[model samples]
Target chain A: MKTLVVDYQAGNLRSVETALRHIGASHEITDDPVRLARAERIIFPGVGDAAHAMRLLAERGIDRVMRERHAAGIPILGICLGCQIVLEATEEGGAACLGLVPGTARRFPSECGKVPHMGWNTVRSREDHWLFRGVPAESSFYFVHSYYPAPESEEDAIAWCDYGIEFAAAVERGSLVATQFHPEKSGEAGLQLLRTFVEAG
Target chain B: MLQKRVIVCLDVRDGKTTKGVRFEGNVDIGDPVEMARACYEQGVDELVFYDITASAEGRGIMIEVVRRVAEQIFIPFCVGGGIATTDDMRAVLLAGAEKVSVNSQAVRNPRIIREGARRFGNQAIVLGMDALADRRMPSGYRVVINGGRVQTDLDALEWAREAERLGAGEIVVNSIDADGTRDGYELEVTRVIATGVGVPVVASGGAGVPGHLVEVFTRGAADAALVASMVHYGEYTVDDIKKVVADAGIPVRRQGARPEAGPV
Candidate 1:
């Protein structure tokens, strides 16, 4: 399956691209909206301010194509800031997002340990989902983020991790799957996730 | 829940693994790829490779080493030293490093931290601060750079706050005075920065025994601990340290038989 990793002048595209290559998945790293519209799976991987990332996506007209792809039932995966951009809006810059997922991205509560919960965290499965196909319930995944998405439906959340409080780690709705952690960097368990996503297609 | 991390730091010089006292008097240890694969089989939580020669050589050799290690090890690994620009970070990540640590460069160009975190995501950017306890300094600790050879007037706590503000996802506070001492972690210095910064802090240097790891986690307020000399010279295994931490009531990733509880 061909995977398209969207590049919006933000995020670790090379790492994600290298990871795909590691798994032997044919893929392309592109910022062009036309190319993104043709991939079997679209990955919106980003790192940076949510508002600025959204603006860049809009600038390149890739945002509309992404929404259309989602509507067409193409699987989409967002990591960190990419996950936040899928929300209805973000508190980072009070910017509008894709609204594919009914939620709002806000800075993690200050009292909850720290702003960015860095390092490896054990994710507990909320429900059986394809993303967690070979992943164990006690498996640890690398996480680095300062903000989190508060999804409207708890059912949409497939996995959760706790810092100072329990928060969604992986969210899925049909063909759309998003995780705050970088699967490309999460080790074997992470690679298994990508493999599962590829097989799901 | 966050699992207690067991990190093995590989200090590379001239494309080979090396370690020294207070970042001085380096000695060739072994090959980076050999050491990294060994640590991976031991089930280490993460691997940190620092190019000790980068700042002086103005280039990085760990990129190829990282690529080779990543091919063998499926766990998360971080690469540090001489990361001055986003392009530098991109090159390392493309070569297979999960995270890129910036120390001297971030201190010199604070915007590099912002750009790296912005472009690669905060998780990919780790700020490494080599701090020395200076009684004469106003903040009690001073930030040191260039492998702890150059001392800056900037306060350690102040730099940590700035790193977080600029989008650093984590801070690795290395105590220059206690490095390779085998005494214990500099709790006082680590606590001040940990409490000051809003991101997770990993305490480096001065870990001699299993008890020291406990002290770092409980007393130092450190989320994780980075060890070198102790693990390198076979003082303690990664599993042994995790067992000690777990036996002491701290949560650690357990892989084998737990060790007897040690005195905290």
Candidate 2:
């Protein structure tokens, strides 16, 4: 029942720590590849530059460990920038990512209202999965992203959130799940989403 | 659907929650941490803990207060009022606050906005502008600092545009004329700034009722409305204000925000 939140200098580490504690889920924030590999649950919590994060993941060999875990079919979640890097590549920094999921990260159009679609927006997901559990269909979550993942297959998008254009708010296939919004900052319902992820296989 | 937001602002001076009329004489209100937790229970979307005393005294933001509030409240909040540099912004965000607002210091050095936005994401940096109605200014509004005691040459509209260019995720367009007046927001200036910038704009300074929120959200083109005096004085509870806003056709995160979780 070990949960390891992979920390690649993510700024929201404490916030995630607070939420996991709220749901009574004991977890550890680690970058050690061995520790990350052995953890029963993995969450890639991120904020800040994607390229810098990718570089650190490579430098620390966390990317290799993540790939290994994903291949093993372990439950993994990526939040915000953490979610972006899970894809194959990102327009941000033109950086290559782990390729855990089948997608690429692209910037939201500048003319599409705001460059950074920063605020609370709804996620519409019809997919039946343990990730959402009791979460409402169109629940609003706090998002602060200039870029979002465009999954290769439309069915991979568990939830779609519209800003300038509808983008993958949550993408899932098999055991891999990631959200473009911060569950830790998204109030009570968000905490429940985190709890479901932690408790479910 | 992207819903409009209602943010509760707690003006803290010397570690005590305080409120003043038009940024003048102040009176102690209550413990900020306790008050913020209570408001969180009432379904306020977010809270902004402002370091009024520190900002006015030429000191740094009160990080201690931010940590206290962050520890108690689960929802996101912003720490503002004395943030002077990128390091200050980092300290605030690292202290568990989701956003850091820059006001007087931003006017002094506009580069702080760009640097802070570069270091932290733009979403973490907030630009707080105290505006006064001025016929001579291009936008018919001038930027003020130091609790509205000093007015800058920058126009509200122009500065907002510049802030957006420099990577400010949101702007707080506070009207000096309307602040603490209990009339309403200075809609003229608010509209100019909101429509002027592509980023989200927060209508601040004079929120007296829930309808004022609707006025700002619609006519003012604001993404969020900042409320202080109205909530601080107990004229309206957060739930009461939210019900009014929801009743007015504005969507809010009213469900599952209660301390004890249940169906909405």
Q: Per candidate, chain B TM-score? A: 0.91, 0.92
Native A-B contacts reproduced, model 1: 0.56
lDDT for each residue of candidate 2 in B1-264, tens digit (9 for 90 to 100): 677888999988887888774456888888888788878877778899888774433333367777777776777799887778787788878888989999989999999999988888788889999999989998899999997999789988999888888988899998989987778888888888888888889999778888898888888888888998787767777878778888989877675366332111
- For model 1, residues B1-264, the per-residue Cα lDDT tens digits are 777687889888888888775546878888889777666655577889988774444354566787788776666789987778899898888787778999998888999999987677777789999999998877799999987899998999999989988988889999999987879999989899888877788999988898999999988998889988777766676777877898999877653211232211
lDDT, residue B97, model 1: 78
Steric overlap count per candidate: 0, 0
Off by over 4 Å in 2: B21-24, B55-61, B259-264
**Candidate 2 chain A, poorest ten consecutive residues by summed lDDT:** A110-119
User: Backbone clash tally for model 2?
Assistant: 0
Superposing all C-alpha atoms, what RMSD in Å does each candidate have to the true structure? 4.0, 2.8
Instruction: Report the poorest 10 consecutive residues by lDDT, candidate 1 chain B.
Output: B255-264
User: Which sections of candidate 1 miss by over 4 Å?
Assistant: B21-25, B54-60, B70-76, B84-90, B104-125, B165-167, B233-235, B254-264
TM-score of chain A of each: 0.96, 0.97
